[model samples]
Structure formats: structure tokens, C-alpha cells
Target: MRNLLMKVNYDGTCYDGFQTQPKGNTIQDRLEQAILHLTGETTKITASGRTDAGVHAYGQPFNFTTSSQIPLERWCLALNARLPQDIVVTEAREVPLSFHSRRGAKRKTYRYTINGNRFPDPFQRRWQHHHPVQLDIPAMQQGLTHLIGTHDFTSFASRRSTKTSHVRTIFEAHMEIDRSMCRPSSTDQGVIYTYVTGSGFLQHMVRIIMGTLIHVGEGKLQADEVAEILAACDRAAAGPTAMSQGLALMSVEYEESWE
Candidate 1:
């Protein structure tokens, strides 16, 4: 058997999530079904990690072993033809059999978007969280700076996570405001973009961090208290988990060159 790696992007609005579950209607289930149709082989595609329902992905990598003779270059087109309109196989390549998608990933980047408009924009509702109150961007940025180092992120992780260790290193964390998306009548807050690159994340970790930073923006929590929350190593110390629709898997990095 040969291994094939593929990079895919999906809207993720309708599916349950990335993994195949008993309930079905998931991104993995659809991809597996398409592959079974195209190659007549039942293969499991291992993604870098699973994103929650309603979370989109811009650059998700997965790999599967196949005995089929399909050319590597044609895999993307072939799979796209079989996949749903929302999920597209962006690229595919033949990889070493030893390569594993999830285990090989070195870092993952996630982006959380917020629509700061008082009235939610109809067009952006599916991909952004709507927040009517004006947020203090400077305070949020200050809070984000504290998250840029290796630390135990238990405060920001979901209690449902089964991972044994809560320690994770965050390489970069920042927020950007997209002024072009703001309405004239609304506060200059516009749209808020939170980007985080980390070694790995626990379930709902990014969302939880976003919620905490949002509290800082609202003056409910001080920027300096983020470090205290980290040291507390307690979930109750963190803010609520933000809505899932605003979160997206931005990209995955690997030490091994796929080229």
C-alpha cells in the first residue's frame, strides 16, 4: 500500500465535525465515502486534529493508505468531483508510508473572527460571532501578549478534554481589526480577528481563550489577570467558551517537507 496526503478546505457549516461518528454527516464521513467511490478502497483519512461543529478549515491536512493506482496529481480533482460542494480537496501528493498526518504536525494555527456590528451582518453571520457591545482592542491585545509562551493552558481548555497533559506552547497570538468590514454608523471596532499559533490545543481551547480576552476587552477582566488565570490552572478561572462558528482551523505546520 502507498500513502497519499491531501490538503483540504471546508465550509463546515452543515457537517457535525471533521471526524467520522455514529451520527454521520461529518466531513470525514463524506471524504471517506467519496474515496470509497473513487478508489473502491475503504480508507481512513487522519487529519491534523478535529475541529468542532460549525468550525471552518482553510488548510487541513490528512493522509490515508491506498492500494489504488490513481496518479497523485489527479487525486484533488477526482476527490472534489465526488465531495460535497462545501468540502474541496485543495491538493494531494504521494507521501512516504511512514508519514502520519496528526502525529507529524508541529504546529497548528487557528483564527477566530468577531463581527462587532450592533446588527449582525447577514453575510458574515455564518463565519463570525456577532457582538454588539464595543470592545477595547488595546486591552485585548495586552491580554493576548501573555499567552505567547509555553504554559499550562488548563484554564482555557474544556473540562471535557481527555488529554493527560494541559501544557501547550503558544508561539504567536495576536488580534487584528479589519476596518473595511465595519459599518459607518458603528464604532470603529469593525471586525476583530484573533490568530493563535500553538504546538497544540485542547478541546475548545481557542474559543475559551477568545472568551477570556473578550472579557478583558469588556473591562470585566484586567489584562494582567491573564497570567494569574494561567497560574491558577483551573478551568473555572477562565471565561465562557465563545461560539463555535467564529473559530476556524487556519493552517498546520510540519517539520517534514511535503514537497
Candidate 2:
């Protein structure tokens, strides 16, 4: 059997989520069905992690062991042909049989986009969280700094998470204004982008952090209060969980190639 690693990008607006559910369509379901059609094998694929419903991905990596003799270079093309328009296999390569996408990942990066415009852009409605109220970018940036380093992220993690540990190390966290997508009519404002890279993330951790930061941006929470919230380790002590549409899995990283 050969283990293949593939990168996928998808628009999650129409699917339930990354993982398969009993009633709704998912990214994994579509990929498995495509593999079944192309390889004639009911192979199960493992991903680096799952993205919640309405959350998109720019670089989601997964691994599957198969007996098919398809050329490595052609795997992306084959899978793309069978997958839906919203999901595309961007790349594929051979990997060691021992490599598991989720277990082998060293870190992952996620990006959350916010539309700070007075009026929502029709094209960005599906991807960005539209917040009409002007945000204090400096305050949000300060709040993000507190998220760096290892700590109990219980304040930000979702109650639905089944993980035993709420402690995770955030390698980097910051936000920036994206002016390239700004409208001519809008002044002193641009799209806001929040980026976080971490060893691992609990369910809805990033979104919750975004929510807290948004609270800081709007003057509801002080920038320094983020540290207090982290120490509290109480979910209720944090701000609301931001909308899912704004979050996207940017990339998964490993120390070295498994090839």
C-alpha cells in the first residue's frame, strides 16, 4: 500500500463541515466518494484537523493509504475531476506509510477575515464577518499579543470540545489591515485580517479568540484584560464566539518532508 498526502482548498459555505455527518454533505465525504470512484477502494482518509461548518480552508492536508497504481503527479487532477466545484485537490505526493496527517503535524496557521465596511460587500458576504462599527485596530493587536505562549485556553475553547487538555501553545498571533480590497468610498478603513499559528487548537478556539479581540477592539474589553480572561479558565469569562464564516485554515506545517 502507498500512502498519499494531498492538499485541498474549499469553500465551506455549502457543506456541513470537514468531517462527515449522518445527514449533511462534507469535504471528507466528497473526497472519499471521489477516491471510491477513481480507485475502486473504500479508503478512509485522515486530515490534519477539522474545520467547523461555514469555515473555509486554503490548505487542508490529508493522508490516505491506497492500493491504486495511479501516478503521484496525476492524483490532484484525478481527484479534482471527481470533486465538486467548491472543493479542489491542489497537490499530491507520496509519503511514508507511518505518517498520519493529524498526528504528524507540528503546527497550523489560521486566518480570520473581517469586513469593516459600513455596508457589506456582496462578494465578501460568504467569506468575511461584516462588522459595520469601526474597530480600534491597535487595541485588537495588543489583545492578540497576550495570546502568545503556552497557556490554558479554556476561556477561548468551545464547551463542545472533547479534548482532555485545554492547554495549547500559540506560536504567533497578530492582525493587520488589508487595504488592497478596500473600496473607493470607504476612508480610514480596510479589511481586517487576524492570523494565528499554534501547535494545536481546541474546537472553536480561534473564533472565540477573535470574538474576545473584537470586544477589545470595540472597547468592551481592555487589551490587558485578555490575560485575566486566560487565567480565569472559564468559558463564560470570555466574549462571544465569533461567526464561523470568517475563519479559514491557512496551512499545516511539519518539521520535515515525510517523503
Candidate 3:
């Protein structure tokens, strides 16, 4: 069997998430169904990682084993033809037999967009979180710094997550203002992004981080108080988990690539 690696992009507004679920439509289900329709093979596709429902992806990657003789160059075109409009296989290529998408990933970057206008932007309503207030940018930036290094991120994860270890390394964490602001005759300057690159993330980690940072901006939480939360390692110690729509999986990095 030939192993195929693919780069995928999806608008997560209409799906349940990346993994296959018995009840909800998902990215994996779509890809596997498409592959089965084309090759008559019930291929089990593996992804670099999972993204929660309503979370978008710009460069998500996955791999699947197939015995089809179809040229790798045409895989993307062929798959895109069968997949829904929200899900697209942007690139595909052959890879070594042992390459595992999730296990082999070195780092992943996530981006969360916040709309700071007094009114929500209709255009960005489905994608960006509407804050409707000036978030203290400097204070938010300071909060992010507290999470930049390696630490147990239990406090920033969902209470229901069952991971064995909560320790994760954050290589970089920062935020930037989006001056181009979303439409809405409001502040016309309420778009900002919080980006976090890490080896891996726990459930709701990024959203929780974003929310915690926002709390700092609102003066609800002191910037330095984040350190205490991290050390606490309790889910209740962190801020609210931000809405999933505002979060997007930006990119996944692997130690080596077939390309």
C-alpha cells in the first residue's frame, strides 16, 4: 500500500470537528467517504491533530494508506471533487510507510481573532469573536508572556479533558492588532489576533488562553496573576474558554516532510 500525505484546508463552521463521530459530520468522515467513493477503499485517514467544532484550519495535514494506483499529483483534484465545499484537499503526495501525521508533528500554531468593535461585524460574525470593547492590548500581551515557555497547562484546558499529562511546551505566544478591522460602522479598529505555537495543545487550551488574556486586558485579572494560575494547574483557575469560532488551526510543523 502507498501512504499518501495531504494538506487540507476547511471552514469549520458546518462540521463537528476533524475526527470521525457516529453522530456528527466531520472532516475525516468526508475525506474517508470521498476516498472510498473514488477508490472503493475504506481508508482510515490520520490527521496531524484535531480542531474543535467551529474551528477553522488553513494548513491542516493528514495521511492515509491506499492501494490505488492513482497518481499523487491528481489526488488533491480528485478528492476536492468529492468533498464538500467547506473541506478541500489542497495538496497531496506519497510518503514513507512509517509516517504518522499526529505522532510525527513537531509543532502546531493556532490563531484566535477578536473583534473589538462596539457592534459585531456581520462579515466576521461567523469567524471572529465580537468583544465590542477596546481590549488593553499591552496588558493582553503581557498575559501571553506568562504562557510562552514549557509548563503544565491544565489550568488552560477544559475540565473534561482526560489527558495523562498536561505539560506542553509553548515555543511562542504573542498578539497583534488587526488595523484593517472588520466591517461595522463601529470603532473601525476592533480586530486583533492571538497566536500560540506549541508542541501540542490540550482540549480548549488556546481558547482558554485567549480568554484569560482578554480578562487581563479588561483588568479582571492582573497580568502577573497568570503565573499563579499556571502554577495552580486547576481548570477553575483559568478564564473562560473563548468561543470556538474565533480559533483556527494556523499550521502544523513536522520534523521532516515528503515534500
Candidate 4:
């Protein structure tokens, strides 16, 4: 058998999540069903990470072992034919059998978008979180600076998460306004986007970080107080966890073992 890695992009607005479930549609179920249809064999695929409901992904990676002789290009075409319209396999290639997508990943980048305007756009409502209040960008940036290093992110994670350790390294974290990316609406205010790239993220870590920064932006939390929250390691000290629809897993990086 040969192992193949596939890069998938999906709009998570319609599905439950990435993982397969017995009741609802999922990215994993659809991909596996498509593979079974094409190759006539049930293939168990593993993904780089699990995205929550309503969260999208651009370069999510997954690997499956298959004995079929179909070309790599056919994996996309054949799967796209059977898969739902919301999910698509963008690329596929042969990989080492031992190369597990999640275990081999070195880093991941996620972006959270906020519509910082008085009026929300109907078209972009499903993709962005609308925040009517004017945010103080400098204060938000100050809070982001404190998040640039390694720390125990217990305050930024969900209480239900089963992870043993909350300590994770954040290589970079920043927020920026993308004027050009904002959809035309009643208000011309630019949209604020938080881009976070880290070694790995705890459950709901990015959403909680966005919530804390939003509080800082609204002047509810002091920028300098972020360090205190990190030191406290109390989940209740952080702001509310933001919605999942505004978050997207942009990419996952791995070493060039195949190259």
C-alpha cells in the first residue's frame, strides 16, 4: 500500500466539523466516502488537526493509505465529484507511510476576522464576527505583544479540553486591519483581522485570545494587564470565547521529508 497526503479546503458553514460523526456530515466522512467510492476500499485518513464547528480551513492536511493505482491528480477530481460542494480537495501527493499528518506538523497558522463597523454586511455575516464598537488598535497590539512567547495558556482554553498541558509556544501573534479585504457595506470602517501562528494551539485558545484582545480594544481590559492574566492561569480571568465561524486554519507546516 502507498500513503497519500491531501490538502483540503472547506467552507465550514454547512458541516459539523472535520472529524467523522455517526449522525452529522463532516469533512472526514465525506472525504472517506469519496475514497471508498472511487477505490472500492474503506480508507482511514488522519488529519493534521480538528477544527471546531463553523470553522473553515484553507490548507488542512490529511493522509490515507491506499492500494489503488489512481494518479495523484485523480484524487482531487474523483473526490470532488463525490464530495459535497462545501469541501474540496485542492491537492494530493504521495508521501512516506510513516509521515503522520498531525504528528509531523511543525507549526500551524490561524486567522480570526472581525468586522469592526457600526453596520454588518449581510453577505459576510456567515464568515466574520461583527463588532460594532470602535476598537483601540494600539491596545490590542500591546496585548498581542505579550502573547509572542511561550506560556501556559490555561486562561485561553476551554475547561472541557482534555489536553494535559496548556503550555505552548507562540512564534508570532499580531492583529491588522485589512481595508481592502472588507466587503462593501453601510460603513466604510476597515475590518480587523487577528493572525496567529504557533507551534500548536490548545482547544479554543485562538478564540479566547481574540476575546481577550477585543476586551483590550474596547478599553475594558488594560493592555499591560495581559501579563497578569497569563500569570494567573485562570480561565475565568479571560474574556469570552469568540465564535468559531470567524476562525480559519490557514496552513500547517511540516519538514521537507518528501523533498
Candidate with top lDDT is: 2
Candidate 4, residue 116: Cα displacement in angstroms equals 0.9
* Predicted candidate 2 versus true structure: per-residue lDDT over 1-259, tens digit per residue: 9999999999999989999889979999999999999999998899999999999999799999999999898889899999999999988988889989999999999999998877777988999999979798999999899989999999999988789999999999888887776768765367898999999999999999999999999999999999999999999999999999999999999878642
Report model 1's TM-score to 2 decimal places: 0.97
Q: Return the clash pairs for model 2, or none.
A: none
Clash counts for all predictions: 0, 0, 1, 0
**Local error of candidate 3 at 115, Å?**
1.0
Global CA lDDT of candidate 4, please? 0.89
lDDT of 1 by residue, 61-169 (tens): 9999999999888888999999989999998888899999999999999999998876788887889999879898899999999989999999999999899999999
Candidate 3 positional error at 152, Å: 0.6
Candidate 3 weakest ten by summed lDDT:
181-190
**Per-residue CA lDDT of candidate 3, range 35-81, in tens?**
99999998889999999989999979999899899987888989899
Better of 1 and 3 by TM-score: 1
lDDT comparison, 1 vs 4, better candidate: 1
RMSD of each: 1.1, 1.4, 1.6, 2.0
Computed on alpha carbons, the lDDT of every model, listed in order, comes to: 0.91, 0.92, 0.89, 0.89
In model 4, state the lDDT of residue 149.
Answer: 86
